[model samples]
Target: MIWADFSDFVSHSRQHFEEGLIRAGYEEVDGGWSGQVEHIAGRTEIIISLPPRFPFVPPKATPANVADVPWSWHRERNGALCLVADDDHDGLWWREAPAFLEHIAAWFESCHGDWKDDRPDLDLDRYFHAANDDRLYIYGDLEAYRGEFVRFGTAPNNAMVMKGRGTRPAKVSKHLRDQFGYVADLGTVDVPPRNWKDLLAHIDASGYLERKIRERLIGLLVLIYQRGDHEGTTFLKVTPTSNGGIDVRRLRSGADTPAARSARSGKDSVELGTRGIAVIGVGAVGSFVADMLIRAGVGRLTLIDDDVVMPGNLIRHLVGPEAVGRPKAEAVKDQLGRQYRLRDDQVEAMSQNALTSDVVFQVIQNHDLVINATADFAVTAFLHAAAQAAGKHVLSAALQNHGDTIRIDVLPPLAGARPLPASASPENHQEPTYYEAGCGSPISPTPPHTVIETAAVTVRHAIGLLLDEPVHPSGEIRQLKHTRNQ
Candidate 1:
């Protein structure tokens, strides 16, 4: 039988008057809650009544049973839910109405078959008297209705705030505005007006005008405008039980105004870093290529690889022992992330191998320059085919085993160059590959190591190539061939 609290039933009173049933005290039945209803199908009946908190709270219910069952309904044992007594301050009274009706309905059916006189109130016809005695009112017509709540943006005052880089957490709001002499418009949050004249006028012409604060203010204003209205006034109000993200109650759905659009476009472009470069593979040589590009002021560096640093690589890799186990891309990014002059976002890390032409093509298509540092033949072949097809400039480098010599090549679009046959001698190849043999071996862990020393030279050359600067001592290829019969 369902038993809804009196106070709760009235608050949730909907237009429909659904049925309710009282319970049979917390008793364990063989078939569960569903099966208990079958047991009392013939002997018991119920009458649902609405309390003051009608629709918003559970409804009130009383059951009448004749098949000799002595029992009273009780709440479920687990943790208390919305419809349970613990959820209500008035002791299961002012909860919700519909929930009450549901409980009563289940209890009425439970007492029919498991008839026992030892149970309390075995009177099948007397249950309806409780509803009549309390004079519980019936809400809307006994009809069913279903609806749901929809929220836009964040709800209430809940907001997600990201601290700007180098921004200290001191009185952020006041300090930012006071120092920068800018105001964070908490209004509609659309687009901030360009006229900082008013805020500037309000600034104390003395101690408040520091360069650092002024710089932060300008940066913050630009950032806010870039985020546009969505991140503005939208706040979420959520309790622990809420679903999805924070709820947003206020919505601004109108199209962007011309001024807002222009401001947003300008702000957005400046914030997007560089979107036209891909770095495939961040291995030994690849890292050098990326470093050269970054130092030469390349637009951005998008790195891709699926390998992690291992202990054995401590000898030759640019990264140190601290970065031993990190993904190469991430390690590269971590190193670059600390470089204040560099655009951190520009150095992305794709934790996957550049295995196919398609994979190379997808990344190359979006970038103006493709730097293949992976030093893998499969990856190199894919890069050549894809970058050549897409007309993207490709730079690839490799080194012979240990420290024989280094090879760096610039592959522009195929253009008018002679194409080699599917099968051709190494000498007949149009593009030259530097095959350095026994130039120098790396000195073990000491300062005058060959790998450490030569790497510096090769990286400088790469930088010159990227920046179109003059190469020192001419950028000609050198081959260290072995002489026989001396």
Candidate 2:
């Protein structure tokens, strides 16, 4: 039952070649179907070995073994072609092997044609989805703990600062400079681009350094990109030539600082390296809170809101009036998402009300933490219930007394605690003067400074929640006691 279709394709191909219908034939070899398809350019052999799962799991085809085919450039080292660029393709896109068999035949024809033309792909490394890298070995796993010194201060000779631990020095010897050969940054890459050329072009485009200083191009260019964990910064290596081409290779960050030179980032390293968090609301209070959370390094964040940026929101929100009328969630993610140094797909925007979203719980489940800065009681209540039901933690915050006070509540898993009220009823919000734009409810007159105050308190509580510290009480109430003399 498993091999019926693939067996049929092979059996038919054998009979077809026997009767001269096509230039391909199949024979059993080493327990798999082996065949050669003769194209106009040349003939190439293919071996179709189906995993026991067959149609459910697509079989792989490998060409007859060849030597030293440059696994860096060719995905297949011993002439095996990964049948699909992606192995786990959707069943809808790839249901069976009949079409795949046809694909392999065509791929062989194209490869043979390209081979004879002498114009082969220069950037073939990008084609391989799963990397088969074992060429370069890091001695001592040296990169795992290497002290990181970022270039800082424009004071000539631009000094580097060691982002050291609490007891560590703010400055250290240029360890990376002294140890690595000609290390040049290709700038920040959150993830590998689909094309390997995006990384290679940085080295190829000329002028990373002065020709005099860079006469000896680094034997290996250290490319910094985002990885999948805390302290997520990682690297790769590539060798560039005079012709502006580079051979790309995996150079995982396996080096670490020796005990004598440990300039490790602090425990508060935001611990935000790659934590998945969700923020509900992106209004004035929500916007400011989101901005600080990102700055403090909460990794992946899902921003949810259904409101557009009102001209009034600009006065207290992080975004300017120029962004008026855009979805507040998108605006917040766009403006402040970059500075937080999130992952490639880390900051996501959902322009929907959390109370009404069906998959709201699923979204909450995806994150390590969920924050409700929406200040909507219904929404806050809904998230708290959802968070508790899902065995997750949620922080809900709101402004009160027309921004004179802000309240923060943290609900531990299954706490069943209702966060404080967002505001008084529509009629009694207690605004001395209300701004009216025609017919809707009157808008409260709140200052940007007040919003900033709320944001500061919210961040402190949120940092504690994310870092598992008891810096702020679970239901902390912060009041602005000092006032200007009227």
Residue-pair clashes per candidate, as listed? 74, 13
lDDT values of the candidates?
0.43, 0.57
Candidate 1 matches the true fold with a TM-score of: 0.35
TM-score of each: 0.35, 0.44
Off-target runs (Cα >4 Å) in candidate 2 are 1-266, 337-343, 412-430
Highest TM-score: give the candidate number.
2
lDDT by residue (tens digit), candidate 1, 1-486: 245665444433333232222243223233211112223345333333444444455543333222233333231111111133433545553333344445544444443433233223111111111211111111111112111112112222332122112333334654332111122223221112212232233232343422424333222221111122233221111111134221111111222233332343333233223445577777766665566555544557788989998776566666778899899889877776665245566678888878855677778777766666665787777777776688765666555433344455556423444332122123322223343344343332212244444445555554544445525322324333333363
Candidate 2 worst ten-residue window by lDDT: 147-156
What lDDT score goes with residue 157 in model 2? 37
